[model samples]
Target: MKKTRIVILGAGYGGLMTVTRLQKQLNSDEAEIVIINKNEYHYETTWLHEASAGTLHHDRVRYDVTKVLNRNKVQFIQGEVLEVKAKENKVVLKDQEVSFDYLVIALGANAETFGIKGLDKYGYAITNVNAARRIREHIEYQFATYHTEEEKKDGRLTIVVAGAGFTGIEFLGELTNRIPELCKDYDIDQSKVRIVCVEASPAILPQFDRELVDYAVSLLESRGVEFHVGTAVQEAREDCVFIGKRGETPKELKANTLIWSAGVRGNAVIDNSGFENMRGRVKVNLDLRMPAFNNIFVIGDCSMIINEETNRPYPPTAQIAMQQGEVCARNIAKLIQGKTNLENFVFDDKGTVCSLGEDDAIGIVYGKKIKGTAASVMKKVVDDRALFMIGGTSLLLKKGKFNFF
Candidate 1:
């Protein structure tokens, strides 16, 4: 008898966690597992901001995907996923099509532009390792060119970040730290450099309480960071951004570097596959399976679950995705065992931490609010814990953030 073939897509936190758990829970004869990813490695999506800001090297952000997989139980495939043929139970890749008895869609997300004009052409997004490296390189080029040209463009020194959300704020934090080094390296006056954050929301980090938000704003302000809260980015250009408050004329913020961290939608493959989605995210059943099919599951950014208390969809987060993966693995195992009952996914709210540079942060952990160095330490611990969960002690030590001080 042929074993059940399980196909998992993407090597992100969700997909990796699912595969790692499945390898341990099921025997070789029970299922044949195959994982596909566009790249041969998995990068910590949380660390992309640091890499984009040049504080952390891009190489340090990613690791070989095969390193964590048990070769005996899993086969790794490197290819871009084109689409999913749900009816046929086959996935179309660039090179070939693979059929599966069970399918897990965890293909992650795309940078959401929200119909903003010129953003696709003008703005840089910290989406992946290559994108992060591009932003770092582009920023350095602007700074390096600032002095050498006969007509110095002050716009080159101005950096506008489109969003004051978690990614935007964390990037601003790292950018502030990196600016000093850049000024020193380029022999430019630090005062001439500008770091501005534009948020559509009335306040920065809207999820955090007022106190934590205030602390974050004040700390960043001391470093010459400008906040334009209750403002929207109307448009992006090659050398400037148009932003404005409601009922006011949009003003141009002249800056060669426009980093967009405003929002993200789920992968296009989800929509292409004809699944009903909101911004490419499917609303899965409580068991984490796609509503129309029990053998198909969707997790991570590709799946959306409502927070009953707030009546809002829970933010697509690494913490939630990893939790979904744990539950997904168990459900798949039960199905393979010919069991009717499957475990329902209940998110254990661990908490949230938003970093401010390498040494500062703010968070609500276990219902307690924290900030400064203490919060920063907790941030590193959270990062390390993620590494531990997927690859255990060795992967943690190899890529963990050990510097709490």
Candidate 2:
């Protein structure tokens, strides 16, 4: 009998974990495992904010895929996945095609601009390693050029961040921490630099409890970060952003940099592959497989499963993505081994930590509320834990943020 071919698309948390677990659980002769990703390295999606702020080096956020996957057990293909022909059991790539007995889609997410005007043309998003690096560089350029120009454009020194969600808040946290350093390096007065966060919601960090949210807002404000609550960005231009309150006149804020951290949708491939999806995420079955196709599995941001308690979909986080990968690998292995029983995905709520820069955070972990230094310490532990899970302690030591003081 021919060995089953198992192909996983993306080297993200979900895809990488699935490939790693399957390689260990199944006998080499039982199946041919393959992982396809656009990049040769896997990045810590959670750490992109730090990268964008230049607080952490971009190299620290990425790990070579080959370093973690066993060459003898898993085959690695570096290519962009164009589409999935699920009915034919094939995946099309720019350079080649592959057939699979079991296919996993974990291709991740892209920024959702919500049809906002000029957002696509002017706003920056902290989506990937390269994009983060570009934003960092752009910010630095603006600061450096401010001194060379005969007429000073204060807009060059102002930074406007749209959305008060996790990505936005985390990035603002880092930006607030980095501003002093930037001011010193660029010979600009610290007071002259302005950082503003505009949110459509009434409050920031909506995931946290109201008390913690208030604390976070106060902390950020104390650091000279401005919050424009209950405001929406109407448009983004090369040198300014237009925002206003509901039913109020729009006002323009001049800022060379506009970072949009509002929303994210699944990779476009899900829809392109003809799978029914809401914002490119398929409402996966209990077993993590797509309802439309038995052989196809969707994980990470591309798959949506509802929270039983709230009747709302759980926010797609790295924790859930990694867990889904483990369950996905187990089911695929069982199918290959002729096991009739398949495991359903059950997300364990370990808790969540929203870091407020290097030494501050807020979280609720293991049914206990944590904030300030304790929460920040827990956040570092969580970061290190993720590294340990995917690439072991050795990888953690090389890339982990161990400074939890």
Candidate 3:
């Protein structure tokens, strides 16, 4: 009797959640579970902005993936996934290939440059832990080099952030807190440093309530953050960004540091693997399985679920990914049992919270709007809750954000 082999790709939030739940749902004799990840650890994707801004250490966002797995039932494979041959039911990795009875694609996403020129070459993206570390070190290097030159280049201190989305805003919040410290360290006037956010949209945080958006904008403005709403980034260069407004010529903004937080598309492997997708995201069925293939399930950023109310796709968030993982595990278990009925995944609207530095934030939680320290506290609670969900109280206590002052 051959046990059903379940293979999960990438050890991100979705992948970990599915594996953690599946380990409990199925016995060792029933199914052989395998999880493949490029890295040996899993990092909190939500805390990436903090890591990119140098407010949080890169290692703090990650933990050993094997620590959370049940070794008796789960096998951890460390390798880069090249592609999934869906038709053949085999996954091609850099060094080896593996076949599975069930496949779960949770490969995460890549930075979406959105056809912007030179951004792929010059602009820094906060995609992963390594990318975050590189951005932090690059920013620090720019600050360190400011005084070394006899001719002071103020452009070195000017950081132009592309996109005023959640990531862009959160990163700016951390950068605002970090810049003052950096200026003090480098013996440079804080006023000389400019933190500008360029948004193509007419307003910042367009999906959020207007009042909360206004509050966020006001708070960031007070912290020396410049908001260039309705301005589009025309091009990115090695030393500057060109911006243009409606019916206006592109104006060059001289800044050595350009951090692009515009958007992210699902992993390219989706397209390469021949999955019918938009921006690399597969529109999975209500049960979280691929519409075309029942054996293959897609979760996290790699999967898209449409909102019936708004008739638009739900924004890929950590909250939704975790929820999808739970449902995916149950569905897979049902299939293995030769059951026709599978549970449908529905997202519970828990509201959203956007953090601004350590003690400032804004959000709508449980239908009520919150801001300042209260919202900030809720943000930390949210962060801790995610850890608790995947790894329980022990993991939460080990890697939780306890500083709520």
For residues 32-121, could you state the per-residue lDDT of candidate 1 as single tens digits?
999999999999999999999999999888999999999999999999999999889999999999999999999988999999999999
What are the per-residue Cα lDDT tens digits for candidate 2 across 1-405? Answer: 888899999999999889889989998999999999999999999999999999999998999999889899999999999999998999999999999999999999989999999999999999999999999999998888988974437589989999899999999889999989999998999888899999998978878889989989999999998999999999988989999999998899989899999899999898789889998889999899999888889999999999999999989899999999999999999998899698999999899999999899989999788999999999999999888888886788888899423
The residue-level lDDT of candidate 3 at 69 comes to 97
lDDT of 3 by residue, 52-131 (tens): 99999999999999989999999999999999999899999999999999999999989999998999998999899999
**Residue 367 miss distance in model 1 (angstroms):** 0.6
Prediction 2 global C-alpha lDDT: 0.92
Candidate 2 minimal-lDDT segment of 10 residues: 146-155
Better of 1 and 2 by TM-score: 1
Clash pairs detected, candidate 1: none
Q: Rate the local accuracy (lDDT) of all candidates.
A: 0.94, 0.92, 0.92
The candidate scoring highest on lDDT is 1
Judge candidate 1 at residue 178 and give its lDDT: 98
**Where in model 1 is the C-alpha error above 4 Å?**
150-152, 403-405
Instruction: Quote model 2's TM-score.
Output: 0.98
Candidate 2: list runs displaced more than 4 Å: 150-152, 403-405
